[model samples]
Target chain A: MAKSGHRTPRTALTCALSLAHGLPIGWCVLPITHFPFLLVSSAYNGCKRIHKEGKVMTFRSLYHTEVINDAGLNGHARVTLGGDFDVLTSSPLQDDPGTNPEQLLGLALATCLNATIEAEEGRRGLEHAAEVKVGVDMGKDTEGYQFFLDCQVRIPQVAEAEAQEILAKCERRCPVAKIVGSSQNVRVHLVKQFAF
Target chain B: MAKSGHRTPRTALTCALSLAHGLPIGWCVLPITHFPFLLVSSAYNGCKRIHKEGKVMTFRSLYHTEVINDAGLNGHARVTLGGDFDVLTSSPLQDDPGTNPEQLLGLALATCLNATIEAEEGRRGLEHAAEVKVGVDMGKDTEGYQFFLDCQVRIPQVAEAEAQEILAKCERRCPVAKIVGSSQNVRVHLVKQFAF
Candidate 1:
C-alpha cells in the first residue's frame, strides 16, 4: 500500500505517466509494470465503432423536452432543435405527410421528461412506482422556436400544489431539459445520413 | 416534384451507387456528383477520420432512458454505462471497482420503470402534467448477480388507490427493466486504447 505523504514530484510524474499510458489507476498506485503477464491479464477488452465520414461541422440547435403531471401523477413532454424545421421526407401517411424531425423531436422530448421524473424520484428517496402521460407543443416562427412540454403523473395520495412543485423541480433537474432550456449552441458534426 | 411512386426506387438506386463509388450521403443527395464537393457536404464529412484509423471494431451497448409522471406533471431519469463501469480511466474510483456496470444496469432497470409509467399514462387519458424519480440497487451473491430498480412518481390531487393500480400496469410495460431483470450475458471487446 502506498503511504499517504507530502506531495512529491515522483508521485505526480507517476500519476501523469499512468494516465498518459491509459493504465488502470489501481496498477498505477503500485509499481508493477515489470510484470508483463499481470499487466496483460488485467487489461479489459471492449470494441468501439468509430464513424469515419463527415467533416466536423458547427451549427446552432436547441433541444426541447417536457414533463407532464396529471391524474395524481407526473409525466413529461418535449421538442428539440433551435428552430422548427421539418425533416424533409417524401413519405406520406394518408392525408398527413409522414412524420418530420419535429415530430420525432416531440417523442424524444417526452422521453427526456420521463427520465427526469425517474431521476428526481430517486433523489427524493422514493421507490420507483408510478405512471406518466406526456405532451409537447412547438411554436415556431421568425421570432425563433419555443417548445412547451406538459405531462401528467400518476402517484398515490399527493396534493395538487405539492405535485406541481415536484414537477417544477424535475424540469429543473432534467439534463436534457436543462440543455434545451439553456438554449446553448450544440456542436455536432453532420454525419452520413442513414438511408431508409 | 417526382411522383411518390418513383421516389423509393430512385432513392435506393442512388444510395447504392453512392456507396459503390465511396461517396458520402451528402454527395448522394446533391444534384451535382463532383467527388470533392460531395465529400465536403456529407454529414460528418464522409467519415474521413474513421477511415484514417486502421482496423475495425464493434461496441455493443444498451442505453436505458425513461419518462416519469406523478399526476399532471412529468420528469425524466436515465442511467448510462459510463456512470457505472468507466474502465477507460487510469484511476478508477476506489469506492466501487468493476461493479460499475451493475449500477448502470440497475439504472437501466430503473429507467425502464419510468418508461412503464409513461406508457401507462399514455394509455390512461388522465395523464397530464407529471414528475418522476428513480432508484437503482445492484448486488452480487452466491446465486450470481442481482439488479433492482425502484421509482417513485408524484401525481397531484389523485387518489392513492388509483396510483397503485397505474404503477402495477406501468411495471408490466417497461422493456429494459424486464430484460435486465432477466438473466443475460454481457461481454466486451478490447480495441486500441488511447491516452488523452
Candidate 2:
C-alpha cells in the first residue's frame, strides 16, 4: 500500500509524490514508519482542505496510481505506484489471454454503480442487494471505433419506479458514472435481473 | 472466451448471450468447437452490419462480460461471464488489501490512451513508445464524492507540440477517453516523464 497512514483531517497525509510543476504548492506525505513526510508540489492547484473535519488538513490526494504502457493495446500495463495492479491488454476480438479496454470499462462501470447503490441501500436500512452489469460493445463511428455500454441494474428488494429513482441518484453521486455518463453511448437501465 | 468466431464480415460473430428482450433479432454466436451458433436478441436493435468488410455478417457483440457485486465496495467483485476477472474492492482510504474505483479508472485510461497512441505511432511509422499515467484523486463534493483525474502523456522521439496534436487525435479515437474525458474533472497534459 502506497498510502500514507491516514490521519484525521487536521493531520492528514497524502501521496508523497505530488509534482514539481513550479505552481502553488501543496503537501503530500510518504509512508515512513510511523512518520509521514510531505515533500512534493504539483501543477494542480485545486488542493482544497475543505474536508469538513478539522479546521486544517494536508492531504492533496487520497490515493495515487501510476500506470505505464509502452506498446499500447498489444503490450503490458503495470501500475508503478501504490499496490501492484498489472495487466496485459489486447483487442477484445483477439484470442489472446489478456484483458481489453471493453472488459476494464465494463468492470469499472459495474463496480461503481453497485458500490454507489450499496451505500444508498445502507442509508435506506436495506440489505446490499444491488447488482450492476455493463456490456461494453466496440462499434465504429464516423471517425473510428466507439463504445456502446449497456448497463443493467437490479435492486431486488426495491420497487421498479423507486429503483429507477435510486439509480438516478446514484448516477449523480458515483464518480465513475459522472465521468463516463457525459457521452451519448452510455445507457443505464433498471431491470429485475440482469438478462444473462 | 465467450466470443464467437471472428469470421469475415460475411461470417462475423458476436456474443451469443445477447438478450431475450423481444426486439429486432441480432445474431450472436457462442464459442463452439470451431463452429458457432447464432441466437439471442437484445433491447438494443442498433446492430448494424456497417463493419464494411464482407458483404454480410451475423455477429452482434464482439465481446461480453457480466460482473456482480453484492456487498458493494466492502465485498468481492467477479466477472460472471467470459474469463474470470475478479478482485476485492474497498475504500481507497482504508488499509484493506484491495483495489478501489480510482485505480480501476486509472488503469483503463492509461491503457486505452497508450494503446491508441501506439496505433497512431504505427500509422505514422514511428516507434511504439508512448507512456501514459493517470493520477486519480478522490475528493468530496457538495453532494458526495467526486474524482479528479490527471493524465500525463509522454511520447519519446516526438516533439512536444506534435505530441499534443497526436493526443488530441487519440482522444477522439480512444473509446475510453471519449467516455471519461467528458467531465470537467479530467485533464490531459503532456509531460516529459512521470515524476514518480
Candidate 3:
C-alpha cells in the first residue's frame, strides 16, 4: 500500500501602502502561482500525472425540485423537497438520482440576496439588525420554468421615513433580487446528462 | 483549425405528486450536474481543461461583507476602497476603483441604522428592503497581513422594540457574514516554490 499523495498549493502575498491624507494605508496583493508535477511511489506501482493548475475542479452534479404549492396569488407559502411526489422524476431509472436543487437554489438565492442587500445597505448609512425572508414561486411556460421571488425584509430600529427611502434604493440596486423580479428570460435546459 | 464543439447533453426530468389532506403537492426531480468549466480558447489549443478539485479557475469573485460603525467615530468614519487614493497603481480593478474603505465603513454603519427604521415602517404584511454592509481594514502583520472586518446592517421596516432580537438572528443566519464574524482560525500558507 502507498500514500494518497495529496498536496494543496499556497500563495505568497505582497503588500504596499497607499497614501491617504498624508497617511499610509496598507494594500495587500496575492500573485498568481504555478506548480510543477512530481512522481513518487504509487499504490499501483506506477507514476501518475498530477494536474497542478490552481483551479477548483468541476463536478457533474444534478438537482431535483418539486414546488408543492405555487402560491399562485396568496402571499404566504411553503415548499418541500425529496420523498414521493417528486416532479423531477417521472420514469424511474437506475442512473437517475436526484441532485439537491432545493438546497442549491436556496444557496444561490441566499448568496445573491446577501450581496444585493449588502451593496444597497453600504450605499446608505443605517446600522441595525436586518433579516430577510425570501419566498420563491415557480411557473412554467412553453420554454421551461420561471421563478418568482418575493423577499420580505425586517430591519430593527430606525425612523419610518428613512426606512422607505432605503427600501426603494435597495429594490433598484440589489442585482440578484432585481434579476429574479425582472423580465429577463432564464432558460433551464432538460438534459439526460447534467452540467452547470 | 477545427471548429469548437458545443454539445448539448440530454436532460431527463420527472415529477411526482402527494396529497396533504387531499391537496395535491408536486415535486420535480432532475439529475446531478457538474460546475461549468471556463473555456480559455488559447489555453489548450482552443480548448479548456476542467479545473481540478480545490482549484479555482476564476481569479476574482464577489465576497459579501457586513460592516458596523458606531456613531461619533470621527476621521476614520469615512469608508473608501482601492487605497483611499490611487496609491495602488492597480486602478479600475473591479466595482469601484476609487472606493474608500473608511467611507464605505461609515456608510455601512448608516445603512444598518436605516434598514431597521424602514423595516419598522413596512408594517401590515408589506415587504420591506433589508441590507448588510461589510468593511475590511487590511494591514501588515508579523506573519503576513490581517483584515479587520466591520459589519453594518439595515432592515428598512423593523420596530424599535424588535431591533435587538432581529439583529441577533441575522448575525447567526447570514452565511458569509457568519463565517467572517465567527471564524478567526482560517489559514493559508505562502510557498515560494513547490517541490515534491
Q: Pick the candidate with the highest TM-score.
A: 2
Q: What is the TM-score of chain B alone in each candidate?
A: 0.36, 0.71, 0.32
Q: How would you encode candidate 2's per-residue C-alpha lDDT over B1-196 as one tens digit per residue?
A: 3233222231223322334432223433223332222223243333522111111222254445555666688667766665566766777767777666777778888888888888899899999878888776666544566777778889877998889899989988887888888666676767797753
The digit string of per-residue lDDT tens for model 3 on B1-196 reads 0111121122221111112222212212211133233422111221111122222121111111111111111111111111111111000112222222222222222232233333443543546544433322233322222223334344435554455555554443322222223323111111122121
| Candidate 2 runs further than 4 Å off | A1-60, B1-62
Candidate 1 chain B least-lDDT 10 residues: B82-91
Query: What value does the lDDT take at residue A195 in candidate 3?
Result: 27
Instruction: State what share of the real interface contacts each candidate retains.
Output: 0.05, 0.48, 0.01
Better of 1 and 2 by lDDT: 2
The candidates, ranked best first by lDDT, are 2, 1, 3
Question: After superposition, which runs of candidate 1 have C-alpha atoms over 4 Å from their true positions?
Answer: A1-98, A123-134, A137-140, A143-157, A182-196, B1-196
lDDT for position A90 in model 1: 20
Q: Which ten contiguous residues of candidate 2 chain A have the minimum total lDDT? A: A48-57
Across A108-158, the per-residue lDDT of candidate 2 in tens digits comes to: 777887889988998999987788887666654444567667678888898
- Residue A68, model 2: lDDT of 64
